[model samples]
Target: MNINSWNFKKDILILQKELFDSIAPQTAENRTVANSLLLFLKYSAKCLFLKWLCQTVENLK
Candidate 1:
């Protein structure tokens, strides 16, 4: 709910959008590679967000 948390979420969203945009225009030959890279980014982002959420919750206690 705070400014820092808001900024963190915004940054994550921007990074995700940029990643998706970068991979969206690849050739068919590179589709497999792009798919894997996108999957990796998605999982990494989820992990990062979860970690941040945990820390934020801990700070509130």
Candidate 2:
């Protein structure tokens, strides 16, 4: 089959739609990763503070 026989505009539109569809999931995934990273940072800071507090208490004993 000749490439010219295909509908070029329609093919381009389809490809564009597919590209957007594929990208949509990545956008959602990025949001999830960002949220997870924030949670991790918060938890890490809390843990560090607790550890430091415990060490200080032990030092006083």
Candidate 3:
């Protein structure tokens, strides 16, 4: 919830965007698999971030 942690989260989001942008799939099948993997990773990251944020909020109190 602090400025430092907010900046850190922003940096992480930038990194994640760069990472996802760097992935290039050539064939249709590869593209499908890549999309699926990307979706799964995004979902997982959201879940983890929410969990961490909840814990941080609890600790702050």
Candidate 4:
């Protein structure tokens, strides 16, 4: 995939980190939240992409 595209894994990771943020009440808490955020982003990203594709196809002639 093109580097400029949102579908790139690197871009996803970067965005995930940015979205997750590092500020937390403790180190372990930050780590746990980070892991959960990563999983959430991965699943949500795939699901959203699939939904978008399905909708686009449904709109086709």
Top TM-score model:
2
The residue ranges of model 4 lying beyond 4 angstroms of the native Cα positions read 1-25
What C-alpha lDDT values do all the predictions have?
A: 0.93, 0.95, 0.90, 0.84
What digit string (tens of lDDT, one per residue) describes model 1 on residues 1-61?
9999999999999999999888777655488888999999999999999999999999999
Please give each candidate's TM-score. Answer: 0.51, 0.70, 0.51, 0.51
Across residues 1-45, which tens digit of lDDT does each residue of candidate 4 receive?
A: 565674678778987787666643467787999999999999999
Estimate candidate 1's alpha-carbon lDDT, on a 0 to 1 scale: 0.93
- CA error at residue 36 for candidate 3, angstroms: 0.6
Candidate 3 per-residue C-alpha lDDT over 1-61 given as tens digits, one digit per residue, 9 for 90 to 100: 9999999999999999887766643356698999999999999999999999999999999
What lDDT would candidate 2 get against the real structure?
0.95
Candidate 1 residues lying further than 4 Å off, grouped into runs, are 1-29
Worst 10 residues of 2 by lDDT: 1-10
Q: In candidate 2, which residue ranges exceed 4 Å CA deviation?
A: 1-11
Q: By TM-score, how accurate is candidate 3?
A: 0.51
RMSD of candidate 4 to true structure, Å: 21.1
